[model samples]
Target: MVQADACDGDADRMTIREAIREGLREEMQRDEYVMLYGQDERDGESFEVTAGLHDEFGDRRVRNTPISEAAQVGAAVGAAATGLRPVVELSFSDFIGVCFDQIMNQVGKTRYMFGGESEVPLVLRATEGGTLGAAAQHSGTVHTLVSHLPGIKVVAPATPAASKGLIKESVRSDDPVMFFENKAIYGERGEVRTGDRTVPLGEASVERAGDDVTVVATQRLFGEAMAVADDLAGTAELEVIDPRSLYPLDAETILDSVAKTGRLVVADESPMSYGFHAEVMARVIEDGFFSLDAPPQRVGVADTPVPFAPDLEAEVLPSAPDVERAVHRVL
Candidate 1:
């Protein structure tokens, strides 16, 4: 059930991190069964979003676990299957490696394996993507890897409003969800409702509507796409789409947009090969081939691991210029 409440409309002015904190706080308060726990360094992890949560929610509701990702996630799965909504905070998306067995073989496969006998209502929150000099070990956009797993949902929200709504929805979902939050978007602000206003699963929002090309993007790349759209407004018409949720993707919405524009471009910060951008392009080509006027285009990071150098990193990742060029080329 949606909370059906609204915020001051000032939430749009806050950062993504702030929005996440508010969402968690509100949800935990709204649902007595909701529990929060995860790995934290020194305290509530590197971002400090949950710094004081434990103090308010108490140890029973807000817990700080050991550095074992597998154990923590497994415990979350167990808790959820037993009738609690667990929010597992993964310190970083890369650390999911330590818990792959639990996530892929266990949490992701539980419901189906049990013949729908149980539902794992859990959200794995992690800081993902390149920025803030997090280096190779810490910086990674591994959503595609997780999105490939069955029985789990993957979502990336780039703005405050989306961050809040998406998290609320994920918490309420019966399926396990991997919620990727960009470290760079932590401080970005947007409007958010005070109560449960979910953005729903598998739906894409058209951030900017146009007729030339539909630039499907999400996360930080969504921002870049919008900027690129504005930059190229005088030259060509552009539509910016944010597929807020990756798994359970709303292919029809995207296809409808592309069908209207007769052109397509997918932009994502994840590496190009077999990544989110490529996946979206594949979807368009497979399901909406007749709607395209030109070949679908993609703008994303190179297929190599992220490097530490800022300049080299910029070259590897997608940018506004890159998205602009891809959209124009498709047009």
Candidate 2:
């Protein structure tokens, strides 16, 4: 984890929503070309993350778009290709299918198809994950699907600090970037640096350092694993890492931790079948195979769709106890 002293006492306590808004406000102030648009963003009705942005930036740069996801993404692609840096939100990550063609074909492939002469400086922001009774349609963690695409970058920030920093970096990136914010953590609070502080993409934050086992998690699971680490402090020392950028994964940090611990356990809110957990385990085994004392374990939701019922959702989702059990299994 980044220490408070690193900020030189220029940090303020803010929720994930406020942190992201602050980052967007700072970037828009720094670059005149940075513009934000999405459903209900102008009125700050959609998740309230873009609240007050429209008031500050005016309609030109922070206008609301129509309900059509395809039109919003398609327009953002065209705008980016011309000159503007557009940050378009899709309301929910599950709605990605509505504009997958535009994202995969146009946003992800425009630069390569244009012989590297053109740039798509676009950021697609979406709220993801379950546990809010949003059901399967509105509560899917689809970063794994987007990460599979070649040309786009995937980022999932777990904390307020990371959310602010990653948003700034995504707007500044020349390539198309997919920013997946966990809907459940929108109101979670943490201390974020007040000034211009950006956490680079493709980097992992080691929230807790230990030597017995390594536990890699993302989004909500990152916080769960941290709590599990604290509960098992003396019993089993687990090194917890948050892979902020899923596509350009910080495999080196995970590999080094595994090399030291000789055991691995990956936890994610996504399904277990061919998902982020599998990718992390694959990378560790392929690169750090000899550093294993036991078979690595994975903790995630079942292969079924997320249920709307709270009881069923709790049963399907991976919890802190699940992470603790996985650590015990690896040990």
Candidate 3:
């Protein structure tokens, strides 16, 4: 289920940040080759995603880097190319722009460029989405751009369990996985598997099973979809799906759901113009056209820069009302 836990951050519930920390600790313990680096990751990032990791792994593995996104990412690429598996956190998803060349030209093309000679078993962790008032420069749902590029795998988990499972998978992946954590929904918590729970990189989880409409969302929007579905349960039985992995998207699962419901509404936190929402809509139209009863609806961020104010941020970002409207349109 998308809202797997009854409520977020319960007594036993683990926050997404805590789940991620557990994933890192377990991965680091299982494989000494797995090391973590990035700005303030050891001491704790601004989001506290890596807090206390330094003490557990020490300065050797959880080293800090300079404020050079390009240099640090490039160094990680080089390190992974050799033998070690390094995970680099970009801190903010917006910073990926600074290391675009290193990621796209080098990290994405390394194995293919070498004719399948070597693998880039590295993971890039970054905070995504707005609602933190981080301003336009710091906040964004930029995983859409990274997923468009080939060779790099992408995973965006919504709940604590989903985050924990996918993160462990990303750390052990054979290819470079872009793990986008939604900054807006980091504090929410849910049940996490006790040990060795690894969600495969390219799998989609069905949050709710309904026959009326299919609502596919990622990250923060995924939670919105699930909540909206439960609220609208009296009218439309919504089948909400979470595309945990964006690059190697679980297209078959999504297509099958659309076929069953005969209606699809894609929710993407990114802007709508040529955004990731369009990509999922395209897949349904191309692969499940015959099954669709009505034109698909898309819920996405407005085609404008994210506003820094809380009110404006809510206006620009996808919300429960948007998902409900899309579901209504399809119905």
Candidate 4:
């Protein structure tokens, strides 16, 4: 007779944001060189993610910087080059513009420019999208912009488990990683594995396996696609894939999945123009052209600024219904 494996879990479920914080805390504890800093409003408060980190890690490790995005990012780059793994938060992804010069011109290009002599091992963490109605100024998904640039890795984790794993990996990586987290999904709960679980960069995770159609989604859109997939299961067996890390996309997995399903639909929270969805769709056509049954479909935010109004904003963004409709269209 064999004893069944029984596992002890966290007494209370934690949100995706909480899981990320836990990963950060664990990593910081393991690595003395790891530190965190960010421009958070409400007196060093952003989205409650860093609420207690400063207290636990002390002022030196969790120092709150000025409003200068470029300067702050530049400092992180310098710090990383000198051996510090600084995790800098931009507060909102939309504000990345302020630090775009440093991000694109300095940190991202350092490793390549220096011939790998210097490594900018930094993590830029931000809460993106408009679920809380922060308006156009605050809510935007600029991962596509950063992903297009070389030397930088972009990742958007859709679940608590992935969030924890991806955050830990990003903090430990030698490359500069742009970690985008949705503000809306911060409080969303899911199970996260503990004790050295690592999700590698540029890998896609199959959220739901199927054979009729393939739905590639990221972030919140992934959850929507899953729901839509469940609803469409009786009619069309739907296979849902979430490219957890966007920059170094797992094209093999996506291509293989599309080959099996013969159809592809990308659900993204970002705009359609030059977004990750566009990139994935283009890749599918280039490599999986013969495998595709029809043209690839994308369900995403319209190529326009997010509206201030709640209804209009909702209408512009992708949803479960939109995914379901796209699936039907592809089928």
Q: Report the number of the highest-TM-score candidate.
A: 2
How would the candidate models be sorted by lDDT, starting from the highest? 2, 3, 4, 1
Worst 10 residues of 4 by lDDT: 1-10
Q: Which lDDT tens digits does candidate 1 get at residues 115-233?
A: 99999999999888886677787878899999999899999987788888888889999999999998877877666755557788777777777888988887888888888888888
Candidate 2: list runs displaced more than 4 Å: 1-8
Cand. 3 TM to true fold: 0.96
- Count of backbone clashes, every candidate in sequence: 6, 0, 1, 0
- Across 171-288, the per-residue lDDT of candidate 2 in tens digits comes to 9999999999998989889889777889999988887889999999899999999999999989989888888899899999999999999999999999899999999999988999
Model 1 alpha-carbon drift over 4 Å, by segment: 1-12
Q: Report clash pairs, candidate 3.
A: 2-207
Instruction: Work out how many backbone clashes candidate 3 has.
Output: 1
The models' CA-based lDDT, in order, is: 0.83, 0.91, 0.88, 0.86
TM-score (C-alpha) between model 4 and the true structure:
0.95
**What TM-score, computed on C-alpha atoms, does each candidate reach?**
0.94, 0.97, 0.96, 0.95
**Local error of candidate 1 at 232, Å?**
1.2
